[model samples]
Target: MSAVIEVVSVINAATGTVFDLERDVDVHAESLAGSRETATTTTGRRQLTLGDEVTFRARHFGLRWRMTSRISAYNRPHHFVDEQTRGPFRALRHEHHFEDLGDGRTRMTDRMTIRAPFGPVGAVTTRIVLAPYLKRLLTKRAVHIKRLAEQVG
Candidate 1:
């Protein structure tokens, strides 16, 4: 079964700043430093663009996990989407939307669709465990991005 997680936050920064911060590889790594998450890009690029791929390795649930994602869609300073090519989930797609709210503010939304491995068991696990864990993780990341954007915007 597939599950979805959506989180929205208003950032006191311009869309361009928030958008760029979202795609900054270094910022992403810093945001998840508590997890010891590290990322390596296939092209060694600091910023991710359409068609770029990045592999992230982290200690989650007390075990090391690795996931590779590709930037499948990109519309600069507006929105972007990344899909997992290899990860714990059977399938994962994340959409990041940045809406210009004038006066140097932006409304940022993150939508994630994930499918677990096992069939029925995965469904139950997703709802009871995985979903909540991911929601918290994503929320933390968003907060990190917002703080950085506000400081540097």
Candidate 2:
């Protein structure tokens, strides 16, 4: 298992506003410029729905990566979790959370876990082959999300 990555940003926006917008897949896709796409998942789409699948495709370091993730857990106006069905790593889980500091600002956090193959060998391989790619992806994603959220605020 690889080390999990967590990134956070404080947005000058209401918690409720940010929470509601984040739950709407279409709105999220538009906000993030079509990085995520929603469809009729086998389990269906509902608030806090589990097993509902969604696909996200984006460019990272000029390489296109796609993830078909399932909605595993959620609590409206607070947190949601998604696990990847397809991607580079052997497995991936991502959780999005929000906090209200009572000052009209929302703190958004993203936590991601990835399990790579080959165990120790994979770790070494990743450091050499995938680490840079993943870093660039995370950096680009953070900047994009920050810009999008701030733009809406």
lDDT of 2 by residue, 1-153 (tens): 475777787777777666665655655455445344333344444333556787666654466767787888878778888887876778887788899867778888877777777889887776675656555555555565556566786
Output the worst ten-in-a-row residue range by lDDT, candidate 2.
34-43
Q: Against the true structure, what is each candidate's TM-score?
A: 0.98, 0.71
Q: What would the TM-score be for candidate 1 when compared with the true structure?
A: 0.98
CA displacement after TM-score superposition, residue 141 of candidate 1 (Å): 0.6
lDDT at 92, model 2: 81
CA lDDT of every candidate: 0.94, 0.67
In candidate 1, what residue range of length 10 has the lowest lDDT sum? Answer: 37-46
Could you say which candidate leads in TM-score?
A: 1
Could you say which candidate leads in lDDT?
1
